[model samples]
Target: MPQSHPASVSSRRILVAVVPPVLAAAAVLATFLSVRDRLPDRMAVHIGGGGHADGFSGQGSFLATALGVLVGDGVLFGALASWIRTNPGVQRVIAVIGGAVAVLTGWLIVAVLLANTDVADASSVTLPGVRAALAFAAAALYAAVGWLVCGKAEEAETVSGPSAGAGRLPLGDFETAGWTRVTGSRVLPVTGALVAATGIVVGFTTGWLPALPLLITGVPMALLTGARVTADRRGITVTPSLAPWPRLNVPLERIAEAGHRTVNPVRDFGGWGYRARPGASGIVLRSGDAISARLTTGSEFVVTVDDAATAAALLNTLADRERRTAAGG
Candidate 1:
């Protein structure tokens, strides 16, 4: 007899995935209604409450916009969680990066659409608390979704094919530390630029001291944009010089360990891009997986990768060859 997968049996899995967006929609709708009554005297506004509003308050527009915001976000969060639960090896790469993108996209839409509207800031409505609640609730929903999705993905892939993930090669006996490789050189520059731009704006707004940190922080980030690993018959090479900023390099030989780690911003780290905890470090490389590696230098680096396990295996194989060569094997 065949075994039943958790996804097939657990109703909670579905509930966890479904609840957040539903709640979020309800909250936003409540906010919209509460604030609708408090429109600034000069600024004309309307709600389609009775089918008696114009363009700004058209019944269809309000409903459509609300659905777009709430349902869209809910769908994204739910789908990603589903993907993560169903896929683990892929989990090594997809969770964090994917989750962050989904989150940021959702938040960006919500913030931009609602920030200027009276509906977001009515005196009767404690907007901050509501916002906080939404954030917290969204996070909770993500966790439930991740648990269910991870389980489902793992189960589905088993029957599907050779998704063992990384094609790992054995390292000839040396203490190994887990490592993962990723590609987000694209993201590196973009993040650094945003950080730099933010610093510039804030510095000009406040004082130079606040912006000063950007100078230091920006250099490393800009440099990361140039840093990348490329594979050839010989092995992988680190190239940080390609970027316009300062650069760094590490041949495969110096690598002590590598592995793929999932960084679901919602589930694992709660957000995106470079989060560190008590014993682990992660980078939200993309939506799902991150490439993580620790070096003999006592520093661990993570980057976003499409396929973290494959990247790790490649590096591990190269590192092992270097060790064997040194041992005259």
Candidate 2:
């Protein structure tokens, strides 16, 4: 066999990219057809002929909704990939934004199909605000997934490229839990504040608490609980202070060298939070994975930080500082 030239390799990669998505579409269509009868009548109608302006049968509307969602998702992925081909950095932003859009689009298709009386009298089963909320939630989820896929794929390619992920940086020998230790994560507080504000609104609107009192209380609570790094002799800790639990901590000695890893939530590790891998611990974010610090003692901790490379740099710096201080003292 002859060796493939680099140009041939790039062409092959592009071909590979085009094939899988198309194969996936084919598989979906085949499965739907094979199980068409097993599916609900409304779903069948929806898929077959529900969205015609004339109004479809319940089954038709349902099927139409499903088909619409699949189509929309495909469009979302294709659009994002195309937009970010030349500028990979924009992948994360596009994925998050696109994922959110996908969700919203899915929600709307369902909502509209259900809302249309000609399709089916779905109004009785549907609640008022649920549609908007569902739409927003769906959009948010899809956009997040989009950002994750684009960003991570780009990261992997860049790392695997000729020069990027080369013989790791010269940051010296340090103990990393065979993974990355994240630092300077202070964005979580914003989430806590948002949650707290939502709680306050609900409390006030529902008369569970007076508006004036909640306004007075919520702001301070949000500020306190919002993004702050709390570190101790134990290890670095980060938590949304205002919302629920206190800070979570891990020991410093157990930390692995910090480095960024990108993962697509939709494809790679499922959704967010701590996910178990073969033998490693990692936190799944939009396009980054924070190394899981697992100590020999069996306790494990995950740090949620956006910039993995920067975070790793900070951790290395911290470790260096700690070592210097000890030697000097």
Candidate 3:
């Protein structure tokens, strides 16, 4: 399969995350412009089951609020997309959801405006169930469209992974070998410092008490930005770059096989640092080369680092040796 250039891939991901919310915001604006003369000064934003107006908001406030929310959603998703590079499935999922949100929100605002068309009293406006159904239908349609445009399927078949066909390093029965790598993200420490700085600014302006949360959040993030990943006779050990207290060790007895695979922090493991969900867990830092370990217990453990293929190969060799010893014993 053809590989996309790094710049092009990043650009496409950003476009997927950004375009939907922008269109939604534009739709709100267009609707407001087209029906401004017909709509009442105050429009019914909330309608009861009977289709009568139950709550109202001023025309300007309603439009401004809708724009703000849509823009904020776009920005949030865009940031998430930029950070997550390893999983296209996650990108498509986010794009589909984002498109759906935009369509639904824009449709709702448009519905309120359309219901108020030529009505003197905001309370006299009717928002039928059909209109709500139409909005959902439109949202679902947009979601489908977004899914098609956003990306291809998830990570392709890699040369190495926790699979039966994964490659292994040749090792003699009594040989000892190991692989180690130190991986860290420049973005994390910078982010931590920025967060800490914001906390300090808050502390000086407001009260020290309110800033503690940010301080607590920032300090550890900065300290634990780097990790040392080791694979050897003992299996895999992940320890913090500067400290040893917070460490993870996957014993040789636990891992059935080891191989390399790409990992997205947000998609596979939820976020950076220690993350666990059901039968899978990882010490995820960022998206890129990662060692994937399939355990005997049917769970999987992953850790992101550089030169992961070599690490995985070594791990597989070590595990094979351990298995032979167990069988002989």
Selected candidate, larger TM-score, 2 vs 3:
3
Those runs of model 1 whose alpha carbons end farther than 4 Å from true positions after fitting are 1-4, 9-15, 38-67, 88-227, 230-235, 239-325
Candidate 2 is scored at a TM of 0.31
Query: Clashing residue pairs in candidate 3, if any?
Result: none
- Per-residue CA lDDT of model 1 for 146-242, tens digit only, reads 5555344334332111123435656545534333333554655776787687566434322244356766777567656433544422443444445
Candidate 2 achieves a global lDDT of 0.42
Candidate 3 per-residue lDDT over residues 204-280, each given as its tens digit: 42224436777998888877778999998989999989888787899999989887788767866546778765567
Write down the TM-score for model 1: 0.39
Quote each prediction's TM-score. 0.39, 0.31, 0.55
Highest TM-score scorer:
3
Q: Rank the candidates by TM-score, best first.
A: 3, 1, 2
Candidate 1: Cα lDDT at 213? 74
How good is model 3 by TM-score? Answer: 0.55
Ranking by lDDT: 3, 1, 2
The 0-to-1 C-alpha lDDT of every candidate, in the order given, reads 0.48, 0.42, 0.76
**Residues 115-149, candidate 2, lDDT per residue (tens digit)?**
44232332223324555566667666644544433
How well does model 3 score by local distance difference test? Answer: 0.76
